[model samples]
Target: NDLRMHFVEHSTPSKKNIPVVLCHGFPHTWFSWHRQLPALSNAGCKVLAPDMRGMGETSVPKDISAYDVDTICRDLTGLLDYLEIDKAVFVGLDFGAFAIYDLALRFPERVIAVIGLENPAAPHNPNKPPLAEYREMGADHFLHINYFCEKVGRADDDLLVRIDEFFPKVFWALSGEGNYFDTFKFPKETHYIDALNDPPSLPWNWLNIEEMQVFIESYRKSGFTGGLNWYRSMDIKWEQRKPYENVSSNIPAYFLGSENDVDLKGFHGDDPISLLRKQFPNLRAVEMVSSAGHLVQLEKSEEVNTALVRFIDDIREEL
Candidate 1:
């Protein structure tokens, strides 16, 4: 319950530009936004990227329920309150992007705008089948969601047993150049490690050796249970937010993803831009970076930064 979060802040003395909060996805730290920090900061926005609860230097509770979306959103808002900031723009990727959308939906007043990367703004589908149903449907495919939703400690144990071996394979398979869909053809009973490391593609061009080492070392020290807990709370998050089922984010929102993002295409299997437009009435723009993958920010930092800066500037102009 007492989680001391860690964040990297870049603020100008003038305090002239809009403040931007960057949130990273699972198994990633605030360092995921390392490239965007200076770019956004230099472009005049005050940038804050925090390692969400249970990741990086953040101190979090051991209980799984503590990682729910409501708790995570509170953590971000609490950080803002701690800093005495009123409202700010939010930028996020993957699960981080999902949290930003949740915040906007639940507390639109706290967000001036939102720039989401790789994840879309699809509203909760009340009729969507449960995880167990999805698992049965995905039996032929080695769906990580089903695997993670297993007995609490099962997924965490497997990941800890092969943290080094697991992450690299995941990174490679999910990269733009990787054969991501091929893994689905593997047998249902295939172990995640074996499926992840199968005929691996080394030296992922998007991520260099040093970058890979940073993530590997960070997970090695922190372990993967905290991160996995976020996945465990997916169903709970949906259930808890039932009151807000019909709500949609009314704030200015933009989505930037990659054409090669497997999650965008393979997992969701819906046109993100179209669905996002439906979910967010005030959505400003939807962009897809070519030759980029799930880690679009890291793979095409220049383009991503450019789009982000433009979005912030445009939002500022409107205000």
Candidate 2:
């Protein structure tokens, strides 16, 4: 479990230590935010972006339970302690966004600010449709929640190929038909076809053929079990944090989803903007990209960068 802590630090030796920790979600490495690192560092923030557990070059833990939010968040907390940082801004996407949510909720004392990409506030169970509805719609990805929560052992043993295959499918599925299968022939990334098609988007930007080869090679060498363990640990995390369901993030926050992105539509629910307003009472701003997909960081780097810089400036003026 100690292995998943890979980090890339960018600091310009500034007087005010605006330490910011960025977290990447599933199917992405620290490479997801490659465009933002230099910009943040130039802006005078000490930035640390890490490939989370089971991700790029990070140590993959053998125990599935280690990847739960509590344990994973502790891994980051321990990472901060190791780096001697008392607190920092937390920026995250997808699963990373979920972890950030948990971080701000479970350890608000340690967070300076939080920004979530794509992930909105926690779901209001009453307004949420039954899981069966999504299943009936033939999107089984969320169904993995049930497997992760209840059928860990069975899923652990059986779903390796499926996960590997479907992982890439999420990218195209979320993008809708216009981009479907088009993401398949992106040069040498043919091998991770399923993954490229799945969650996260465009290997060409963050990962070159060589990089992907390295990842696939490492995966074979390391075995997929450790990475898969993360799925099995979710139920444990829910029980641990069940008492804090009503908690809201007061840290200055931003929620940006791609307006053209279909993948985030369902998750965004009926009123995405209003949902964010309810969840983030102190939410500083909300923006959506009309032409981009779920991979807003990559597709709309300029806007994302502007929004991020603006958020930091707002806080600086407040201070």
Candidate 3:
């Protein structure tokens, strides 16, 4: 399964400035970072944001194995190779954050530093059970992980059939004031669509109509399978990561999250920044953007941009 990634690049006046690679998570594309591109470029930093293997304009592989973490890292490293970039600072969100952590661990020399938004760095845990067992353990509940992995094509079909309706609710449900966690109170037999739409409000202020249309149109053309494949590959990634069980990323790292991020408590039920620091000793800073949510970069672009520029400047000075 060959995948050619599409990326947007912004260059600064100084060619010597280290490039920063931005990676978007599920149901997002390179366009997700548009707000920060100009700001980073104006700050004298070269920025490149790519639509990872199976999402956006990138080639989507039919085989689930191709979406594994190792393959995704290879796709990214290969992108750097194609661009003739020897090294770069990696910035990512959600699924992209997971990929950045993997890249930093597997190829530290190629990474100057890592900046993760929303998601934290999780070191390999040998004691943790396989994804399947974990899914079984949570079978009584309606977890997105269980739904996506178990249902697979059916899940994709359901979402795709109701793409327009599904995207808006999911996006809004994950936003700052969405109160998405409350959906969990529903019975375990509740359908994902029904549960996800709980307390759904119209006209998400965080994302404008134009922005919402862009996402809807993109998903309309590409379908959800490409993005869902990333979820399907989780078990394979777990099995493949066995060799790196004791490994931890030693690269310079920083994490930023929204103060209102639902996933912060909904998913892990722990302080992500604290867990991140425990996993990454060189983690330089942890900041939370007030009144922001899972999509912090877009929801609070100015704050995210300022923090990123500051981090870039500090790292550049150290170099």
TM-scores for all candidates: the values are 0.93, 0.76, 0.92
lDDT score at residue 278, model 1, on the 0-100 scale: 65
Error of 2 at 167 (Å): 7.6
| Residue pairs whose backbone atoms clash in candidate 3 | none
Worst 10 residues of 1 by lDDT: 197-206
Identify the runs in model 3 with alpha carbons over 4 angstroms from their true place. 123-130, 133-137, 198-203, 269-271
**Full-model lDDT, candidate 1:** 0.81
Q: Tens digit of lDDT per residue, candidate 3, span 1-319?
A: 2677889999867867678999998879898899999999898878999988878888888789888888889888998898898989999998999898889889898899999998885434466645666476456766666677778788888887877777777777788867676566666566577778643444565567788788878777787888988888877888777776566666889888888988675565455566666556789988889998898888889999999998888799877
Model 1, span 1-319: residue lDDT tens: 3679899998676658678999998879998888899999889888999998888888846787888878888998998898898889999898898898889887788999988898885444677635655577677787777677774677777887888788787877777866667767777666677777443544655667788788878877787778877877777787776776666666899989898988888656455566666657898888889998898888899999999999998898876
Backbone clashes counted, model 2: 13
- TM-score-wise, the better of 1 and 3 is 1
Clashes found in each candidate (C-alpha, N, C closer than 3 A): 0, 13, 0
Top candidate by TM-score: 1
Whole-model lDDT per candidate: 0.81, 0.66, 0.81
